[model samples]
Target: MKKITFSLACLLIATIGSAQQDTYVPKKTNFFSDVMFGGGLGLNFGNEFTNISVSPTALKPITENFAVGLGAQFNYLKSKGYYESTSYGVNILTTFNPIEMVQLSAELEQLRVNNKIYYPATYVSNDFWNTALFLGAGYTNQNVTVGVRYNVLYKDSNLVYNQAWMPFIRVFF
Candidate 1:
């Protein structure tokens, strides 16, 4: 009788403990008003040439770790002649904070680029980069966060199948 009673007590305690430890649910936050701005540089190597790009982005938090933002990129090439391109896009981002200083995020971006040629009057309206999907993981300190992202380009008719290991740093206010 004592053993049965002790088992029942243990079961009850376990149930109560589990009930107290509920999973986290994210809360909705304001947009535009609570926005963050940051930028980064990346090196892109292609079949044609290698170049560097400067990208600036804005992030508006929708929840504790979820945000949506816009980014603009300016790329300069240094081989096989000189060319430049400008890209603009929007991304929906979700950040998961599993630990105190670790964060994981996934971003879906829709991007468009305007390609320009330096020599002669050469420009194409439809020579644009397509939408891309990316996933990233990073570590964050008090005010700065750095991460790497893998970008997959969906449409490749006009552009090459390009993949980039992009590192970004963001400042939160």
Candidate 2:
């Protein structure tokens, strides 16, 4: 009789202890909340140079560790000798997270640019298309990310060289 009662007491204690520990099963989350928004901004000024840039992006999480997105970019510049210029581009971006805090990113962009150059007597408009591939690494947290990107195809002394490396910050809402 003691043996049977002891076994029942043990079983009851086990059940009560298991019930006391809360097993957190996360609720189903909405797709829209799972979506993240982020982008980068840039500004520079000097005696003969001024530059401004804006780029905004939206990302859809494919899984906990990967995401794909699209972004639009715009840039404006004015220099002492060179005429003011405007450039715009569209980019496709992908990011992969190997760990919670580290991210790897890539972007393919095509930009259409307009610049003015001195001709024999007057300034003439020069137009060109530039393609750039950017790769980067970043640190990320729950609501913010900071990273640096390098243009693999950057060319020195090239009008297309807006910047060779860019640091970026993104905030998610």
Candidate 3:
């Protein structure tokens, strides 16, 4: 009985002597320094279809849950006997992160295209403009993100493309 009482007293004294302490504190970061860079690139080569596309973007995190950015797009496309086109555009981007690994994104883009049509007798050039609204979801790892987006406002005679669906990959630096 005496040994048991002594052990209990020692345990209580030790527990009171060693107190817990908070060891983790987050450091504040600068707003301008907290920026991410990413974009997408695509190239297709074949006898019937050949194209090159590139887009580069920069983003600034406004809050823990929201981010906004801007991007530029350039594309060159050619068909075997059809026409060749060069297009350029600018985009505004917005992204929301409900979780760490997933993101919801929206973009507004305005593009201008110049096309040269090849004909046996004569060649003609045309210039046009297109505007697109893209909405999609993305999966992001530490530094890479991949996603698919659809142009909700797509038209057949748009300056850029007739396809409504587009896949994208981005790397953040």
Winner by TM-score: 3
Q: Is candidate 2 or candidate 3 better by TM-score?
A: 3
Clash numbers, per candidate = 0, 0, 0
Top candidate when judged by lDDT against the true structure: 3
Please report, as a residue range, the 10-residue window in candidate 1 with the lowest summed lDDT. Answer: 154-163
Colliding residue pairs in candidate 1: none
Better of 1 and 2 by lDDT: 2
Give the Cα lDDT of each candidate: 0.67, 0.87, 0.87
Candidate 1 residues lying further than 4 Å off, grouped into runs, are 1-33, 40-56, 72-80, 116-126, 154-162
What stretches of model 3 exceed 4 Å from their correct place? 1-31, 43-50
Tens digits of per-residue lDDT for model 2 on 1-173? 99999999999999999999989988988877777777778899999999999988889889888998888999998886767788999999898999999888898999999888765568888798888999999999986779999999998755877689998676766
Residue by residue across 122-149, what tens digits does model 3's lDDT show? 7789998888999988898877778899
User: Is 1 or 3 the stronger prediction by TM-score?
Assistant: 3
